[model samples]
Target: MTYDTFQPHPDLASLVKCYWTLEVPPAADSQRQRIVPDGCIEMIFTLGDDIKRYTSADEFIIQPRAMILGQTIEPFFIEPTGYVNAFAVRFYPYGFTSFVTASLHSLANKETPLELLFGDTPAAELEQKIIPATDAKERIQIVEEFLFTKLKSEITIDNIVKSTVGALLETNGVAPIKSILKDDPSKRRQLERKFLNQVGISPKQMGRVIRLQTALKMLLNRQSDSLTSIAYESEYYDQAHFNKDFREFTGINPKEFLGHENMELSSIFYAD
Candidate 1:
């Protein structure tokens, strides 16, 4: 398996996190991979064999060749049919909504074909160009061209929500939502409704996912020698707290996640 990520263009840096590519060699027996929430949306294009996304232990649907995977609140499973080569763009929690008119709330936990967002004709042309890209750089260029043209001239993330999300991210999700809104209880509900429309999840949930991401980085990078240290540094109250949250988000405990064979693909992503 090979995974790589590249920084987004400077003008888009605030909205886009990065672009990534993954290549998994064919295997006689396909493996189940668990995907957890990262508080982001993704536009993915598959260039290899089809893959199955499992909604339940015994149920799955073939993933769209070119699609947008909305904010996922819970972990889900997927298995590739054969060799997997794909490219994806990871957007900030509130960034994707800037480019699309559809409600992010409706997109939650769903993978909608590109045609659903862009018109069928334009989406088809974009996918056709992407399907034959020479490499990640070429793929990104193709995608950027499409997005740059689609971006509305006046589109921007809501100022209040944008600043609030920035605070949560800056604190690694430790800043309480209430704390951000303590000055005015009047706008709490209003902000939350807007947050869901754009971010697909409640502010509290985004915070947890962001904190989980911090712990994941520590685990993948071996930044800490012990889970206790990881938990403390990640701002969890205790080791048990860390374990519980990890299992809730990842469907596996910290230790098992560190060296498990099934986590090969996930490890590649987090390590990147």
Candidate 2:
């Protein structure tokens, strides 16, 4: 398995988090991997075998060759049919809305094909370019060019949402939304509404995902000696609170996740 990330261009740094590529050679024994939410949207392009994204233990759909994975609220499972090669753009929590008119909420929890967001002809052309790109750097350039062309002129992110997401990130997802709002009750409703339409989840939900991401990093990086120690450092009330949130987002326990073969790809991502 080979996973790497590249910085986005300076013009898009405020919106795009990074461009990432994942490549796993065909294996005799491929296992299903669980993917958890991190509160950001992603535009992905798969150049290898089709993969199954399981919604439940018994059902799934083929992940699109080119699609946008919206804000996920829970963990999901996926198994590659063979070699898994993909290039994807990771967006900030409030970044994707600057590119399209569709309600971000409409895309939540599913992979919506690129054609559905960008027109068919253009999306098809873009996918062609990405799939045949000579290398990861070329793919990154292709995606950046497409995003630069599609960015909206009139719909910059709301200042309230911007500052709120800024605070959440600055604190590593522990910032309280109410405190970020400065206790302005009148803006609370509006913030939630904008978060749904622009960020694809409520402010609180994004916070939880972000907080969980921090814990995930600790577990992946071997930063602590035990779950109890990690929980305390992550500001969980106790180990149980940390465990409950972990299972809710990742669908697995901490001990089971560490050094597991199936988690290699995700570990590479989070450990970075």
Q: What alpha-carbon RMSD in Å does predicted model 2 have with respect to the real structure? A: 1.2
Model 2 regions more than 4 Å off: none
Tens digits of per-residue lDDT, candidate 2, 1-272, equal: 88888999999999999999899999888898878888889999989999899878899899989999999999888899998999999998888999999989999999999999999999999998988889999988888999999998765799998898888877877888879989888989999999899999999888888888888898878899799988887888888888999889888888788977667667787776
Please give the CA lDDT of all the candidate structures. Answer: 0.89, 0.89
Query: How does candidate 1 fare on TM-score?
Result: 0.95
On TM-score, the candidate that comes out on top is 2
Tell me the spans in candidate 1 whose CA falls farther than 4 Å from its real position. Answer: none
lDDT accuracy of residue 234 in candidate 2 = 80
Clashes of each: 0, 0
Q: What TM-score do all the candidates reach, one by one?
A: 0.95, 0.97
Q: Which run of 10 residues does model 2 get worst, by summed lDDT?
A: 259-268
